[model samples]
Target: MKLKIKNKGDLIRLRNIIAYKVFKNSTKINKFVGYRIPRRKCDNYLVKSLIDITQIDASLIVDEVNYYGKMTMENRFDLLGSGWVRYRCDIKDDFRGQYEYRGIPWNVDIKTGYRWAADYLDENDCIHSPEGVDIKNVWELGRMNYLVPFSLHVLSETDRELQMAALIHYRNVIEDFTKNNPVGIGVNWVLPMEASIRISNILISYDVLKQTDDKDILDTEFTILIGQLVYSHIKFIWNNLEKNIFGGKNGNHYYSDIVGLLVATGYLQNKNVFTKKVYNYAREEFFKETKEQFYSEGGHFEGSTGYFKLVAEMAVFGTAMLIRNGEVIPGFVMERLYNNKNLAVSLRKTNHSYYSFGDCDSGRFVKVVPHGRFLSNSEAESKYLNLDGYTKIYGKAEKYFLEDDSSMDSLIRYTDGLIANTKNDTPSLEAVMVYQLAGKRLNYQKKYTNGNMGAEQNDKKVQISLNLEQSVLEKYPIKKSTELIDFKTQNKLLDFTLFSKMGFCVIRSDKASLLFRFGTNERSGHGHNDTLHYEYEVDGISHQKDPGTFTYTGYPEKRNAYRSAKAHNVPYYGQEQREFQGIFGYRTADNREIVEFTKSAIAVRYRNMYFEHIRRIVIRDNKVLVEDYGKRDFDIHRKMQLRKSPAYGVIDRNIET
Candidate 1:
């Protein structure tokens, strides 16, 4: 018996990690992968990917691939003949159309309808899809979903005309932007990170579909053209890396640019001197940035779960591409990714939702599904669209809520084929990977109708089960009822936590929890000016929240309001607000302190220019006792407020953030 590679664990650590080596010919590998996908329906293959990235068994790709295959078979001369001038679009829809610029819901639109039909808008004037029906900012929509329609055209191998029409649309869109919008000008091109993100989408889409195209000869030319446009995008990102790096802002956007460039070079196999140099520089910076952003103690110091979600995505996607391109992931990068997952898991509740602490700008580093959704409500979908036209035209278009996927789940699911953590449950050991010939999903259910299981179907569903050490798993203790127990003779519950390295003091009992933040505060970006701030939750429902970032930069006053100490459970003086240093800026001080911590109570201290603020909070039964001691007494006010766009329910009648 031969000892072949057993699981993803074995494959990940193989002596040669180069996926398709920098200079090696990939034709042989392509041939091997080609023989693999066609034998099964490609839809199920993508369902598995979606299941990993999102906890949904997404069949949208399957629907899309089937539709694209049909559309490709059609020869639409009118669409193919349309030039760049014909592709010109505008945002001059009715007054309601612009709300999608920030994903605001519409009364007449479907839940996912908050999309701009920017690029795909035809003289057809079809803004209504059964999936969603609303107006959106054209450019934002284009950047977010360009790959969805583009991939359909790429998969249309048999019909050159269909392929050409789709290709032409993509070409015209790029041509218009490049001709009119230079490096620093135009809406989409202004931010280098924006351009880089779109480029990453294009490249990833290209690689996924490139292997399975059936056109043996004629279609190859079209791919070459697509490659040319992709190369141009890479060059644009390359030119802007210095600005992104030199500004010295360690942001998710900066990391996005790096991840985009790294993934592109690895997949494109650009052996050019400059491209190679960019790849190497990006590789080193990625590691350094990882260490700085994610603390070894399993904390994301940027101080927001949302930003943590964004950056962790960059790490996962970028690392996956690098390994696919034949690069070995460093041990530290892998471990940090694990730590990143750990922080996310800690925040996760039983329903797969997260605990709110900081700002979440309503989206992710990568778009999980091809449509828009409500981040606040998991049930917000087409069934709630309240429009007959949407139902009539598209016929119960299924709404996919990708935003609900926990970052912890995404990490475990997407990396199923690439790497397996030994730390994972022993039952989840398998080497099964879904394969597809077309850039689409495989039909595992259809193929195995006669009690047969497809080889890819054998790929078990990825369970992101973690054997978290008892220290990391926070649990609530049983507390006696305040009415029944004698106040003086209460039994203390020993479930108090002191995250010393992270600067958090927590006191939790079975019915409620109290958290005081005295940790490192980020002076800029996702950090809030609520150090020494505390929050309270009763029975898993939020009572006192951090007022989390409502709309940073989007709504300036509100952003300031949410980040100000005034919005948290903290005592401050007068009506004077913390100095607003600019967008993404705050006033941070080395004021983190722990005055006292006992079995059932915690005392914390913070010093400002004139006074020292000491707060002692005790959790006994159903009641909380808060005692404030100020060395130099001044007019001090304490508060907590609720979010207008609340992510969780408010169990307490009187709510303040």
Candidate 2:
């Protein structure tokens, strides 16, 4: 960290002193609460939205919370939950805090919301993950979420003793670093995103909790103890932001860290000149990321549905915060945000859950559901059942992005009057969320009321929504934009996006979804090795699933398996794995063209130096026929994935390879 001589090294020196002071003050006990956020004002609509989610009587929320007592089960708890409870078969030693990576604890009890002590170590002084593999970099990043109670407190004001437990847990871990692991030289702290996520959660959650009418809750003895630790966390991250911010490893973690810096500057009132210097950089990085991060079709560039949804959570919260504050966000940023939501809607229409493709750890940021589906991939049997508020946006997102009247009723009913536009009628729930949180609106003078976002406006009080270029209403009038909803491609439901630049395709039909991996250049950031590999989902349930990613980091064998064709259904002619420029990106390869496709079938011809692979596929009447055209060596044979064995004797039925 270069000490800026320009400011007489004051900011640099001050940051250093605070870091040392925080480490110096390490102890079993201390006053924690000190960070203060401006209290937020809420109208009836905002209050209604919160209450409807928790299913708590709006009257009861005025008081302190009762932990997760009132939390809705539809919301996910997967945001920060990881490696806490490893299977006995995967563990070599049953020791507390004996996780393979980062010396963090395993065996986390969800019912109790307590992580075991952090002193457990293997014979080799290394940590392991649930996969029974050595992942030494695991630094208890899962603890950053501290969900159960944190969720309640983030949304409510009182009755939150769980918050105290979480605070104490993290405080002990932070202070334990002095005797156990020192800063910059040890685990957890080695990763910039770890610090960014931890501090960001603390700061943003603190800001949200402070918005409550109960100032008394903020002054509580337990809160003060936790607040000090949060301060230390912020100071630590701020001092090292230069080191942690990703230079070229532009993955989801990069955005997460940059957004954290943005929050520190936007919400944290007190800061030195150095903090402001990095703060400006954070804002610039945010703008840069918004434009380049996701695909034109709104999919996350990470090549994983789970990560895509996770990215959406960050976008929702980040944009909501900036918009709520009347920040003049670039119009291009809003366009991308809506595009993401729109893509999610398209995927959901084909399948209720996010069309889960590629690698998935099932982590979430916003905890859209009260009950989580963490390790389980996308829920298939009950795709729409047991959904939390976030996943419920299938209809609402459709209405919000497409202005389709067909979904307007469900979107309105689901949000409890939050959606639905009334030209001359009273404001609906959607209108309220937009007008209230958006603070007058983003468009210059146009009014945004009722079912329209960039919709035409008759009133002057409500602000019209605009892009950086101009008001979207002028370009896309809501009344006539119904054409957008009318599918143009043969595959109905508006499934798939074709990148002519790369010849990559993502398609969804009544029978299955087909993905042909492509890259813009040699590295498409999240590109994979499977060029013509395709996955089939029967009624949104994976009959043939693409083995997404192996793990975030660690275990070379596992990483290779995930990134290779070993688990993929596609045949790799000459290579087992797609080459990469670095971690989190893939190298370009032979481009495959879709020779033919239809509502119920697709055919592709792929050629390379090693071999020529031609595949023709068709689906109808709950059955599938796939033909790979090439000269056969001798007798023909085939295999099929079946729920039950076929008859003993039938034409081509008993044939085998």
Candidate 3:
């Protein structure tokens, strides 16, 4: 959408953006070059924590690491968790900067294929082009996240032959990338956010390799080569910060750039004058964006649960690195992190999955766990249960299934490990790193009132309990043991919560769980026109589900269709809650309000431009009564033919209205 100043806040943000741009072009920040890695190495807290964690099998770690390591070596990758897609470089064992998607290579023409990152003017349009090639598929390969396991293995494993193989592969892959993808060129360098994420992973893996005992494998030449790579990434990210602050365009991308600066600065052993100034600037922006991007009530301001998990992962690692350097985390920062963790816990279903509400391309700052639906594609069912048009959104015919992602669960476990001073037998390397970086048990309870997060006045009114049988809770227990909840506890009542500011009212009972989404984000492009849309689950199975995001820029029509009101379960009156302006935003709609929310029932209303929708959901012993008090023609109980995008690229079309 074209930028419009609707409020003073918008005007102020725009002014700040102009000023920041002016300063970026005409200050010492512009004159700064980069720093090199120091020979002096500190204690590798991550490696130590991995060794200290309980119940980790040595043989399994070796096998899993080898599996992915060999896959990386063989050029096979599961991009965005959409099954394994393989591409062959024209030159064997070379990073030629060409990429592939579903066996179709794109941006392959040497003359017109890819350009220097600096030459691209309308970068977003290029990346999201409907030219039959998804840039994400290309950028995913450049992220080098697949090599993370090998990096961690070198530090923790004792097998000499295996460790040597991993070390060689890690060095070779990075060296190849640095050689081919120069400082500011190629499709890989098109976006600063991509560069930010890639550099962070590179430094993290490099950190693991540097601390390992194999000194000969990581010799002076390789270390210097890595030093040059880090310098290039830092320079590129500094020059190309995604600071298009008009109309809430800068969400996770800007946040990621700041976090990347912090990580890159943290990794620099020898800090020069220029590196020091950039580091200080990044530290200042990190805390400010925390307040702006995250809601005071604990949820991310952006509407997507997937983006929430992604930003949370970045925030947790950023916070951990800052804490490791002896920086005192501000009280407000701690409160947001803790509250976000609680929200993550609350969003977890009985089967340990979260509902994908907004645009979730399975984006992550880092990947620590090798298993989960996040890494693997959704499994197809033999027989189709085309409920709520589960098949149509995926663009398929009569086949239905939902992909599972546990990255949020991994974050929850990381927070649990931090506070409890234990890993709880979780294999998440990020969790152990956080626990070790904290240096001591974090007193999270002291930040927000008695381990609960929200405005102080509404704390009591926001949470209510409903009685459920022990058998039901046991039947669908959390897959991993986390300190967030004690399965062994005597409390048999599930807690229902309302994050008023974040606009999610969750009602739970013995029979079912319902989630109602209200509110509109003025400054976040991730907000969907899904107001008053509700998701219902019974006995740990999704009876009615929200059709998640498919592809963002690859198919603009599909992107808009997937996020429209008709795609949701709300009563459609042939008009959307808001009109779509672009792939990521909409013309502001009238905000939905909560009318009544109690133990037995929940009511919400959205006053649209054409008509008002007052949806009332009543909870009973064995069923839910969805009543819409609006236009007589609007049917709350209508068997609508909606579409659902289960995975990023996979689709199943098999239902109707």
Query: Who wins the TM-score comparison?
Result: 3
Best by lDDT: 3
Residue-level lDDT of model 1, residues 1-657, one tens digit each, is 112453332232121123223213333332222112232322211211111212212233434333333332221110100100112224222212322111111111122323322222121133233322222222333343335334543543446655544444433343344333322222343344666667666555554344433443215444454454445445556655533332465767668778877755665533556567878888877877777766554455566666667677677777765655456666666656655554454454333444556665544444433222322122332232222233343234333222232234444433332344323442211111111111121111111221111111223212222343122122212111112121221354635555444456455554555566765534435666666666656556654556655343334565577677777666665432346665466443446566455555566666655445666566655446665555444433444354433321111223443
TM-score of each: 0.59, 0.57, 0.76
Candidate 3 Cα outliers beyond 4 Å, as residue runs: 1-66, 94-122, 153-159, 213-215, 244-250, 371-403, 420-428, 437-441, 446-494, 620-623, 637-643, 652-657
Q: Candidate 2 or 3, higher lDDT?
A: 3
Give Cα-based local distance difference scores for all models: 0.44, 0.39, 0.59
lDDT of model 1, residue 330: 67
> Cα deviation in Å at residue 548, candidate 3?
1.1
Residues 1-657 of candidate 2: C-alpha lDDT, one tens digit per residue:
222332322343343335445655323112221221112311100111112223323342321122222221112122222212221112222112322212233323232233322322221223333333333224433334443234344454344564333333333333333333223223444445565666555544444344442435444433443444344445455555433223454767767767666554554434456556766677677777777776543556665555666665565445544554446677666555544544444444245433344545444443212222222222311222112232233322211110111121222211222112222243332333223333343432212223211121123112222242133213322121011112223434424344323334455555445444432332344445555555444555543444444344434455555555545556444444455444455443554555554444445555544445555444444334554553322111212221211100001112122
Give the per-residue Cα lDDT of candidate 2 at 106.
31
Instruction: Return the lDDT, model 3, position 409.
Output: 69
Candidate 3, residues 212-297, lDDT tens digits: the string is 64547767667666666666667667766778664644688888998888887777665677667777888878888888788666
RMSD of each: 16.5, 14.3, 10.4
